[model samples]
Target: MTTDQPVRAAVAAPGGPRPPQDGPDRGRGGPDRPERDGPPAEGPPAEEARRGFLAKAFGVTALLSAAGSVLGLLRDLLLARYFGANQGTDAFLVAWTVPETAAPLLIEDAMAFLLVPAFSLALVLREERPTGPDPVRQLVRATLPWLMLVLAACSVIAVVGAPHLVRLLAPGLADPQLAVTCTRITAFTILPFGVAGYLTSALRAHHRYTAPAAIYVAYNLGILALLLTCHAVWGVRSAALGVAFGSLLMAGVLVVPFVRGLRATRRPRRPCGPAGDSLVLIPLAILPVAAFTLTRQAQVFVERYLGSGLPPGAISHLNYAAKVSQLAMTAAILIVLVTFPVVARALAAGDLTAARDRVEKDLGQATALVLMGTAFLMACAPSVVALLFERGAFGPHDTAVTAAVIRVYGLGLPAQALIGVMVRPYFSIRPVVRRADDPAATGRTTLLDWYPVGAMALGLLVTVAVGVAATPRLGALGLAAGNAAGITAAAALLMRGLLLRGIALRLPRVLGGQARLLAAGVGAAALGVPAAAVTADPLLSTLLGGTAVILAFAALGTALGAPEVRGPVLGLLRALCPPSPPAAEGKLPHGR
Candidate 1:
């Protein structure tokens, strides 16, 4: 089946993916059915319609992500004002690692990598054999229950071993007790994080994105509310309380839509796919994916580990800087989040060319987006930091430290975005057709294709080595540099691995395009800084710098003949100022 059909967002709508009207389980899509249950819409109109829907989805996601980030910004501001960048904040951030690590496994990386493809395959299977047990429901029942149990058990283990975690993660921390207390509170997030991730995977697989994207908004709102209400009594511990409570809200918001979607589908039969066939291939495939995630995230671990021995507020500075820098990467990554399922479905259909094109396009687009963001961020880091966090207990000294660290993190944003782009194809949806050699039965991608973990492991080791060498003299700056170096190395290796793993992405073109974008970004930053310096006010300086970077990035990109970067810029311009159609014979309609 051609994968370019209008990707109906109703995949999770109970009445969405229905069989023919006369077909069994006939009460198909309820009131919200987008199209009839038949062959898909085709031609240019269909294509345009598809683009419209995807654009809408992307917009909705961007809006929700921005909302969450705003709330998160407020939460960070509250912390900066109340807790300040001190030993207490450092200890609390150490506990924050609980939710951080859990996010990749349960919410973002491992779960989505494993399940989006699985759910996509299940949807395919259901479409193929409509009369049989619904594979979607079957997959959920077989995996979700056991998955929740494992996650809950992990949560309990984390709570029990909070002290051990604190010691291992940050041995030299001055306030280990506070860190331990915070870890114990945040440990409860494992269950909620797992469930939320699982639900997000399921929802996205069915073309449902609103609830998934709203999770962060819900999460940050929860944190902002709890932390504010409890700050006077709870002190720094309020941050941990917010994290735990917020995670619950993350999962809670998705429940109704998840169940509603489930109910709309047909009931399941006992025997689903083949005899003893499984929907989730977690037992085997998860090892490398999980390892890669852990290793990549270990940059933070390494920083805090080494930073613990530094001054009391060093870790806090790194965390604060990282928060600002990540916004650039996050905006770029939204492209991948929306298109990941398309790539998965393409691969599942055995359409390598389609998947290759999709992945390549997404990489270039995301790269351009992030490079521009980096230009703005690195150029305006000082002004941005002062404007956001210089009030209350946070002062000019803290702002200087955070600005320096954030620029280092900003330099790595493109690498982060690239890795996000590449990983989708690395774990593309496998074919559901089972093979005798397939023990996990997930599909073509397997343990032998475990290069990402090794690559990330190498990066983490590099991070550790670099941090150890530089942390003593440079302090948090050294740690920030280590993170940048490691991620850049990993991003390069992952690019080459795509070729080795038969992904068919043209590395020369991709690298060349990146080289051009890098030049454009540098130019953007170079000009943006001077433009920012023209203003004395922090907020005004940031605005000027940000505007200058966009103008420079776009102009320099087009001038350098980088169409991959140019295409998106032109599209945005047209969207803002569409031209009017010419009047026939030079006469305006109904005039004179």
Candidate 2:
């Protein structure tokens, strides 16, 4: 598959792998044919076509993810109104930490980053020898059993040790017992989430994105339903139970699609290859990725742990603020998710240039979106937080603290987006050797592999040190600042590492684009701040001010000639209202 082809479902040919039909047209002519064109035709419009496909796919995924985020927002609203940032909510948030920490390892972007490339490589290799045993199937079969075993052991440990873990995560909680009970209920989600991760990887490999994208929506919906129906009876513990049930529901939602994807790709197979032979390479690939995830998650753990030592509501404040700040980041991540598998596929096929191009584009676009979001959120943090979470048990003071924390977190949105895009290339880098027994198989052996882990470690250390040092004085604001510093450092290190490995990022161009976006963002804030100030009602202020800000950003971005802004807008317009057909021959009398 070349860059100019629409990513399509693979079909087997009798002789070999069939050409993907969705690619650019190669005019039919043997070498014997006379030349007819004035200039030699360039490569088929594959890049443009692929971009169109991505744009449409991203638009759909964004809509679904936005819907899920809304549900998540509602969940937070209920938690705030019903419980506020009190001991009960704090206890629940502590229990929630289990999933928060485990998600990156299982159902979040880290899992996708690690597995997509592996699955892509397996699929490509299998396609090369269509009649051979399917490597993807073999790989999954070999890996799943071990995954289940590890998951089961981890779940048992977590269940048995929930009390100890709760004490460790939030030592200052007023109601440690409630947290322990909630932790026990939430611990079981680890196994289901692990299963969901595998299913997500499988679906994405087959280019089946709808089901994977919808999994979060389903998960959130399940939680919302349970909380509504059972919260009265079960209290805050209901939310914990909801999480476990939701994880199962999340995985359940993907099973049929995953199975269908497998059936579509299935071929008559001989006995599978030596089962454990393929298993060695998986751990080799996963370990560094896992290390990176652990370090990232550790930052959150550190923040919450330190926040616990603050006022009673401090943990809940941090959680609420972080969730609101994350809304934009989550949307940016969903947009980038569309590109991960494509970049991985390119790398698996040994097209380094294509992979690099995809990474650069994804980084720029995600950054632009995130920065725009940062500008809006930071400028209107108070109004936004107040509108979203100021009613019921969530009082004005809670809104003020949460808003401040959100503003601080907004400072890091661009760095977060950059890390999200940059890390994928490292994960997608094809290994030179697969043998675990090889002396050079250690992760640190190559700069390509070692730098990401090193960057992550450095970031984690900075986060813990800064968070621990500052939280006592500045509370959640200090923690948010530490997170920003840490991620910024990580993003810089990752960019530097990529450059050292000769992957030129054309940093000047990227920075220039970012500068334009920043200018647009500032211009938007200039207009929005007053719009927000003029209104006394928080909801009215947010709606009116947000609309003005968005309009200003779009206008300034277009005037600045930002492709990241213009391209998507144009693509969406085209998608919604396609070009009109040419007037019929000699049929324009009415117009005349």
> Best candidate per lDDT, number?
1
Clashing pairs in 2: 4-46
Error of 1 at 549 (Å): 0.7
Listed in order, each prediction's TM-score against the native is: 0.90, 0.87
- Candidate 2 per-residue lDDT over residues 511-554, each given as its tens digit: 78878888888888788888878878888888777888888888
Q: 137-250, model 1: which lDDT tens digit per residue?
A: 767776788888999999999999999999999999998999999999999999999999999988877767788899999999888888889999999998899999999999
Q: Report the Cα lDDT for candidate 1.
A: 0.80
Identify the runs in model 2 with alpha carbons over 4 angstroms from their true place.
Answer: 1-42, 270-282, 431-448, 568-592
**Model 1, residue 210: what's the lDDT?**
85
Q: Which candidate comes out best when scored by TM-score?
A: 1
